[model samples]
Target: MEDVMSLEGPVLKVNGELVLIIPLSAGGDELMKCSRGISEVQGEFLKIVIPEWLAGMLGIEEGDLVCVHNTDGKFHISPSSPRRVH
Candidate 1:
């Protein structure tokens, strides 16, 4: 699990639809949902929050780094990218 800020506020909207935001480092195997959106925070960070069922389906747990992507009209998840060497 990677470190993430737990935000408590109104749900975020992107282009008029709500979305689940995660760090750019996050990745996943498959997307079980459709139509995700993205937004930036403070011009320097990204964030995400997922439902427990989605997390379980994606095998995501607390502290585990996960990824989400969009294809066509659906969203997918997978393990985060491998660390890059400097």
Candidate 2:
């Protein structure tokens, strides 16, 4: 199987709130499961979790390129990337 840079995860709810979880890895050695709102899984990549409502307002969808600016606490989502979950 071809290794992906990012993987899109299904939306789930915890405590009656919508959330989006994603599995991300850089060097393929470590796997991080990150989530928005409430997450049941503890993840190393906790920095990029985007909330569902904000994602919707920004038109962020599965496989979209989400760039997070940690310094200013802002993010930009682009629909140009065609990468998706396999």
lDDT of each: 0.42, 0.40
lDDT of model 1, residue 40: 37
Best by lDDT: 1
Error of 2 at 25 (Å): 9.5
Report the lDDT tens digits of candidate 1 across residue range 1-86.
Answer: 43222222223344544435543333321222242342333233354455567555655455455544554545444646333448
The list of candidate 2 runs beyond 4 A from truth reads 1-43, 73-86
| Candidate 1, superposed: residue stretches over 4 Å from native | 1-43, 80-86
Clashes of each: 17, 0
Q: Cα deviation of 16 in candidate 1 (Å)?
A: 27
